[model samples]
Target: MLTKELIANIYKKVPKQNVLSKIEERYVYAFDASDLHEKVQIPDAVVFVESVEQVQEIVKLANKFKTPIICRGAGTNTVGACVSVHGGIVLNFSKMNKILEINPVNMTARVQPGVVVGDLQKQVEKIGLYYPPDPSNLKVSTIGGSVAQNSAGARGFKYGTTRDYVIDMLVVMADGSVIRTGANTIKNAAGYNLGSLFIGSEGTLGIVVEVTVKLITKPEASEVLLAYFDSVEEAVNSVNQIIKHQICPTTIDLMDNNAIKTIEEYKNCGLLCDKQAALIIEVDGFKTVIEAQMKLICDILNKNNAQNIKYAKQKEEADEIWDARHSSMAACAQLRPNVTTDDVIVPRENLSILIKGIQKICSKYDLIMCMVGHVGDGSVHPQIPIDMNDKDEYTRYKLAKSEIYDLTARLGGIISGEHGIGLVKKPFLPKVIDNGAIDYMRQIKKIFDPNNILNPYKIF
Candidate 1:
């Protein structure tokens, strides 16, 4: 039970309307985007914070009461990163969304934690600037959540992930004290790269209040092409061949036969469902070089046994191709009652084996899976649609999940590529990370959050 004094103290720190203490209001904050069916503990209170001072005040109150302070954005993370497992105070950043500054000369943007990723992209693109960490759900995902999970998408093959752009951050430490992670300027040769520690920390060490991200000039021209292959090997080999020819496309995303058919059925996007796999390749650069890049990429695709290659002739067609690729999860969800997605990455050489292994495992377990990935970077996202209410199916899904991680380990790859190790992946962290490294991580966690009040029992 929440004490009257604690409740009163919270109300004093924030506006009365911002404090949510009713059971109905608190219940909604218990779950995130993770598809886990396990019962979750509802938070005792949910507060919509508007300023850094309000966040610090809440952190101080959390320290006094020793309650877990879970920082939340849109709660779109698929790994249960923002779920209130311990039922403490959930600090919602929705009201704090703001883009404070956009410096064209410095090529940087300072933003509040609640700023939506796609919204920022549009605002920056109004100028000639580009912020390139494009998560699949960028339309709804928040920058703070992307920072916590180090989220990446198809563009990651060329632009890198969220960590590459974040230059500085204003973090409220566990003790309600605020600290700047890096300098405002781009180059910071300061003591330690403290920002790196918190970039993928999943809000365990501190609460990110403000962020400064570096930006690059927008590409002058871009084009998208869909290439179908007779077999998975042909698709994988085509990716390698493209790289061997010294051609670097912005994204080389792969979608298996299941994904192609599923998305076609889900949206009738004109995808070739008869092929075993498809590669969605995009190239961007100076307008003068686009035709040359497309010609080279097309020649390589035809040489590698690409059955049918289709290049988007217009911007509408390009958007349709990308929309189909990005809708893999949504398409898969239509096949079953629940859908779960996993991120596993291996070396480019082992890409074919990883894809085949996952397909075989899913087939053996009689589970329906739609596989899509950023093959340019050797990261695959296997989205499985299942009926979670079926006990036998859930059991089989668990077994297949463990075996998939084992296969990933044998292939010399970690379990996660961009998604952080939240509650769903915590049990399997040992499969990829060494004990010594995890021990050090725990020690560091203790040093920063001594009370264990910041997103406790996560990412271990």
Candidate 2:
């Protein structure tokens, strides 16, 4: 419970006009992107902090009062990471969004955590530098949330995830102390490597105030290859074959037939829906290199029984191809009253097996499961359109999800691929993670936050 003095201290420390206690206002901050959880409640007041110093002051008061502090960005998280489970204080950082510095010489950009991903992407692209982590929600998702969740994208196959480019960060530690975690240099062997830790900590350890990420020069050209398969297994086979050929595309994403149908239905685009599965492969580099990669990709795809292949040559076609890919969540979400998206990473060799297993699980649950994901990385998503009003539907969904996770574990896979193990996936974590690893994380949590005041009821 928040005492009157504690709230007063918070009001003094934060922007007085920005603090909100109205029920309707509180309702807006209640839940995040997850639909599995009940309606979120418990934040005593939502305080919008404008600067790093404001974050520090808010953290200090929250620590002193033993109140929960949830660092909220754009609130686009799929897991309950942004949910205030305990009625403490919601540290709203949406006002702190500022692209602080763009160093063209170093090819790095320093940004406040609250900067929206797309806004930064546009800003960086104007200067010929590229920030490639393009989560579907990039238009609205904050970079802080992306870093907190270790967000990935179709480009991850070539460039790797967000952490790979994050060279430095400034974090507000548990005790309200601001510490620079990393250096702008390429290599550093400093103690503990807290920079990497803070990347996917999910707001459990510290609040990220500033982020410095490496940027690469924009590719000279990009090509999108759309290949259709007679069977989903054939599609998976094509992915494995593509990787085996050592021809790494910038992105090789797989979309199931059902998912394609949803996208086509929603967008009214003339997308190929006459296949069991499809591989949307994108390659980028110099014109000659892109053309060569395209030839090799098409040859390998055809060798793997690709029924139909269409290559996009113009900017409109490129955008059309990506538009179908990015609109997946909204298309899938409209299938039912709710949708539970889980990321399960498996060995590339077992991608076909996992797809088959997912089919079985979906059939068993009498649910429609369209499996799609970053096939190049073996990180797939099996989205279940859940009906919130029906308890029995979820009961079966729980079993279906459990079986899928178990199968993934058996195949040397993790419970989460790109998405973090936030509130929704915590229950199934033990199915994939070793007991010792979880124990170690719990111990680390204890050491960093003995009071458990930082984003409680989350990844633990």
Candidate 3:
């Protein structure tokens, strides 16, 4: 419980207007994007800090009161990472949003935690540079949330995730002391790479206030292609054949028949509903090589028995295809009152098996599943739409989830590839990771946050 004195101290540390103590205002911070069936615990207070000094003062108050400090950025994470499970102080980073610096010379950018991922991408692209970590909701997802979850989108097949770009961060520890995780330079070899520890730590160890990320030159040309397959096997084989031919496309995304139908119904993007599966392939390179790359990928698709193919001829067309793909979750939600999405990855070779198994599991539970994935990286997202208020349906969903995780572990994959192990996946962490590794993680958490006040009871 937050005592009156502690609440008064929080109001003193920041502008009174920045602090929210009323139930109605604090209620909004209680949950994140995760569709939790359980009753959520609301935060006692929500505070917005605009500067590092203000964050330090809030941390000090948290330490003094032994309260949990949950860091929230857009609250777009699919997992329950930002949920105020302990009903403590929620740190809202919206006011801290800013792009601090863009160094074209150094190929890096310094940004506040609340900087939206897509906004930064646009700012850098204006100067012929690129930031590759493109989460699906980049337009609204903050850099801090991406760092916390190491978010990666379709481009992850060629570029990489947030973990690859994040080089340094200014983090406030549990005791209110500020520490720079790493030097601002691209490469650091002097000491431990503490920045990495916090990349996917999910706010359990420290609060990240600022981040410096490396950037790369933007591709001169790119095109999107949609290939329809009569069977899932054909689509998966086409992905393997593309790799066998030594062709590196920017993205190789898959949408099963269910995803195709749902997205078409929701957006009317002209997706073929009869196709059993479709591959959304994008190739990026110098203007001279774009045509050659597309031709090679198309040849492989034909050889793998692709039924039909469509290519995006211009930027507008490309955006239309991508917009349809990104709206998949919203489309699925139209089927039921509540929708839940899961991230599970396996070796590329076993990608087909994992997808098939998930389909079977959901079928056994009589659940509606719209599946999509980055086949190049073997990451699959099974989005299931269901009525969470239905007790019987929710029970079956829980069982199906457990079995899906079991199948993933057996196929040599962890439960999550981009999403972090927030509260929703915390119980199954042991199914994929050994107990010894989890113990070490806990020990490390204790070292940084002995009070367990930093997003307490998370990731273990």
What's the lDDT for residue 30 in model 1? 88
lDDT of 3: 0.93
Candidate 2 lDDT score at position 202: 94
Off by over 4 Å in 1: none
Choose 2 or 3, whichever is better by lDDT: 3
**Which sections of candidate 2 miss by over 4 Å?**
none
TM-score of 1: 0.99
Candidate 2 per-residue lDDT over residues 1-460, each given as its tens digit: 6788987887887667989877788777878887645656768889998988888888888888889999898888887888887788888878989999999999999999899999999999999899999887788999899899999888889988889889999999888999998899767787788888888889999999999999999998888978888798888887777777788788989888888888888888877787788889999889999888788888888888997688898989888888887777778788898877778999888888888888888999899777779988888888778787888887888889889989999999988777887788888888887899989989988888888989988886
Candidate 2: clashing pairs of residues = 42-87
Candidate 3 weakest ten by summed lDDT: 31-40
Task: Give per-residue CA lDDT, model 3, range 361-431, as digits (tens).
Answer: 99999999999999899999999999988999999999999999999999999999998898989999999
* Whole-model Cα lDDT of every candidate shown, in order: 0.93, 0.85, 0.93
Candidate 1 lDDT (Cα, whole model)?
A: 0.93
